[model samples]
Target: MANSPQPPLDALYQEALATFDTLLSQARGEGDPEPTAMTLASVEGARVSARIVLLKGVDARGFRFFTNYRSSKGEQLAAHPQAALCFHWKTLRNGVQVRVEGRVATLEAAESDEYFATRPRASQIGAWASAQSQTLADRAEFEARIDEFERRFECVPVPRPPHWGGFVLAPDRIEFWYGADFRLHERQCYERDADGAWSRRMLYP
Candidate 1:
């Protein structure tokens, strides 16, 4: 099929971002918990893994989320650096979803630190306590570590772990799906060309 008539590149790019933010705001207005939650999928060798991760930020650069760099997903991202994200707002009528596919990059340390500083004190401690994606023998042992960090940073501020930070998925493709009657849904996809221009097209439901 012929390509959809293109809009000015910059406006189209901003339109996609604006639409995402609007959907997100509507979800929150509907009283949904974790409106920023998204399914993050990464790969390891011949295996694929997916898990729910909170969306920490998003912009033209792509979606951002934080995790322990030493975790399994982290290692996989380090090896692959390509991932997909799906944001499904079930609270929306019949549910709407946005899909993003992109290459990932670890954010600068300063950016990570800035976000870490805003987290709750307990979470800050947990960052230093939990060995994310690591095998745990028991709950008590993990609690013990948490207690240990609590006391260690009792008076001092808990700093972000060196192994914990943010990663941004710079999308080359993003699709939005709006559920409709009789399963005849509406799908719009915006793709970024090699020259960094964006073109949007509709996909058959």
Candidate 2:
């Protein structure tokens, strides 16, 4: 079934994704820098951590990002296999906030390799040099590791780290919120079904 024609994405899903694209574009036009930045929240047991991560890609399947497999967030995702993302574009007319809840899974090795190849040489080096989310004795030790990797990869292409790759979140629910005057905001929620269909509804603000 290689290269076989695949069925189209669910119509409602496509429409909702297109709306996100339009809003992202509008945020760009409104001069909001870093439109793709989203707050990525992951949990480990009863502990939760939230940090900002840039959205690398998005499609009907879901959102994509890359990180060290051994990092705190990555380990959290490994343990829970679920996460949430929040995107707020403050520069848009009034403002817009989008929240996503989803299950996470590792991306294919080939896809990870393709994206890794496009990274800058320095960043590629960092990927190997960093022991992400691990305690360090000092800053000097980290810089020394970077220097070591740089020398090791000199005159050669840096390969993607085995412990580093990509993850995709297949969203089960997506919510869009718009700011309005007098606190009468607009909220739209879209929930996906097991059969890949979507149901959408408006929520009271």
lDDT of each: 0.93, 0.93
Can you write out model 2's per-residue Cα lDDT over 22-104, one digit (the tens) per residue?
A: 99889889888899999999998898999999899998779999999999999999999999999999997678999999999
Per-residue lDDT of 23-87 in model 1, one digit per residue for the tens? Answer: 99999999888899999999999999999999998886789999999999999999999999999
**Pairs of residues clashing in candidate 1:** none
Off by over 4 Å in 2: 1-5
